[model samples]
Target: MAPTRTGSKRLLHDLNQSIVFNLIMEHQAISRIKLARKSGLPASTITKIVGNLLAAGLVLEVSADESSGGRRPVLLSINASAGYVVGVRLREATITLTICDLQCNSTYTRECSYQPGTAPQQVITIMATAIRDLVAEAGLTMQQIFGVGIGLSGLIDSARGLCRVSTILGWQNVELGPALERQLKIPVRVDNDVNTLSIAEHLFGQGREADNFLLVTIGRGIGMGIVLGGAIYRGSFGGAGEFGHMTVDVRPDAPLCNCGKRGCLEALASDYGIVRTALGTDPGHAIEDAIVNLIARAHAGESEIVAIFRQAGITMGIAIANLINIFEPSHILIAGEGLRAGDLFLEPMRQTIPRHTFDARDDIELLICPTSDDLWARGAASLILHEIFQSPIYEDEEALALDDLVSQASKAQKHHKK
Candidate 1:
């Protein structure tokens, strides 16, 4: 369907606001003149936009800049305390909740675990409670929060807020977002965990300067998020970045993946794959203990353990090479909980990418960003923040009217108290 004239104008305004907000964040402190120049917007347009931003408390005016033979211009910077957002990251073993301010600084975090076979409602109740506790701990009400963003490992139908499939959590067609929204009475956005990481990278991490990048996360599962032309490339069904399911081998005896497939890259290189390999040498160790011992043995220079890590690296390298050859991203960031194995897995992975990559393509920067569950949670928070900036609240007359009414009420209350 074609966008209407009003819709087009609204979109333009949203884009302008986002562009201005990002500029202020990047430059730290910039004058209207510089913002207009950098953003290529007219001076009048910048002035109008800046006024809305200031009124919204998204940007603050700082000290005046040195003038070039004219009136000194005030600098503008992001208002880190303007509002807050909540991020929830759901994993197989645990669910993490975090509340972050406008600048994405985590002010509160809570974590709780759920055993396998636990009902989704049980997990949701725990998460909702944690969110409320975090908000109370921060001494803020729901009105102070912009929204909530959820990052989960699964085949997410983001538009519908459904987890179409999640092998890690054993979920199918789970209406996670709608269910949570009903409980929390707040706006919600849900996306694949790796996609959330991509949002974090684009806004705050290594991809801040690169328009094209791929983020590959390796941990309990393998996942990928692709950013192209400065936005997430969520294919037709929001499942475009399923890199883990790509076949790396077809050997009949290859270990099975959580998805029930055999010979997939994730089956060979993920944490599960590493521990499965370790079972041969550390015969009696449980899965959890086996992983701990696997890393220790590799660090201790055990040839057998070292070989297992090396093979994982080779499979990972193959995956990396394919991404580069297919996407040609300017940057490829490999991150997640599993990288704690240090260089035991990386050195071999690094050594294998060059062998398969096309000439010159192999030179693309590969960044191994060390991340934790908290970072992923922040990534989820970033998704909500990103949307808030793009929302039409700044341009919509009804929203502006509501804000004005709220402000008047607060003032009246304060005057009555005095």
Candidate 2:
């Protein structure tokens, strides 16, 4: 059904406001004229939209900037403290939580060790308690938080808020979102750990400037996230970014992957794969110390170990090149725990990618993102913050009406106190 005339007008207003708000957020302190030009909105329209944002305390006017020609323009900036959000990275070994301001800055963080195969409900409880403790440490109440975002290793059904399969956590079809929300009494968004990192890279990291890019995380496992046409491209069932499962080598002797498949890219490229290769050479070595010792040996001029790392890199490069040939993204970000090996591991990829990629794009930019546990937590928080800023046009009327009620109640409470 077509929207009513009033509904259409409201939608247009919300869209224009979102555009102006996003422009200011991205450009930092931007002048109204610059916002107008960037957003392709008329000056009058920009002014009206900015006025609404300013009144809502979502925008702030910073010091005037030197004018290009006319009077000095007042630069607009996002009010980073207008609200806050929580991000949690649920891992097999631990649960990490971070509180971030509107600007995606981490204000407080907490982490706690957990058993590798902790039950889903217990994980939710731990997350809720950690969120509460983190908020208390930040000296903020629950009302200050917009929402909670969680990232875990798995095949996430994001729309359903379920972790359909998580080899790391031994979870299958866990209703993570509903369980967390039930305890916290707030909105919760759950997604794959790499997908959350991709969101962070898209909004705050190297991918911030590119509308089209690919994020490849090579660590204990291999995962890929594609941002096409300015949004994450989750396949028909939110399983699109499973690049680790992509078959890269069909040779009969290829290493075995955790997915019970042979010749998969992850079987050759992930940290586990690298460790598996090392086991073949350094027999009976301390399995737990395999990755650390393997990289050390390769760096110490061990030709055989270096060759194994090189083979992993070569296989990774082929898969990455194939993806580039198909997607032609503006940039490809390679990140994860495995990147700590530095150029020792990446030089081979750097050399092999160009040899395989098609013309022109062979020189595609590759950005290495050095990731840590904290960054993953921050990424989780960014996920929720991203949703909080979504244009109201996409929200159902009931949700909008509930938001209006909340705003009205807050205003009334303030008036009553006065």
lDDT by residue for model 1 over 1-418, one digit each (tens)? 1122355665676667768877898898999989999999999889988887776666899999888887899999988776778998998778888999878898888887878668888888788888888888887777677678999988898777889988878898889888888999877789999999899888888988999999999876789999998878888888989888888889898777778888888778988788866774322224556677789988888999899888899889878997888999899999987787778889988989988888846559999899988999999998777665443433432122223322433443344346
Please give the distance, in angstroms, between residue 269's alpha carbon in candidate 1 and its true position after superposition: 0.7
| Off by more than 4 A, model 2 | 1-7, 31-48, 67-73, 251-253, 280-288, 389-418
User: What's the lDDT for all of these models?
Assistant: 0.80, 0.80
Model 2, 76: alpha-carbon shift in Å?
2.3
Which tens-of-lDDT digit does each residue in 1-418 have in candidate 2?
1133346765777677667777788788999888888889999998877776676566789999976787888899988876678989987778888889888888888898877677778878877888898898888877777788899887998877899998768888999998888888877888888889998888888998899999999888899988887678888777889999888778887788878788888878888888887775422223336788888888899999888888888888888888889999989999898897777679988888878788847456899999888899989887776664555655443222223423533553344346
Model 1 misses residue 128 by how many Å? 1.2
TM-score for each prediction? Answer: 0.88, 0.88
Once model 1 is optimally superposed onto the true structure by TM-score, how far is the C-alpha of residue 156 displaced, in angstroms? 0.4
Q: What are the clashing pairs of model 1?
A: none
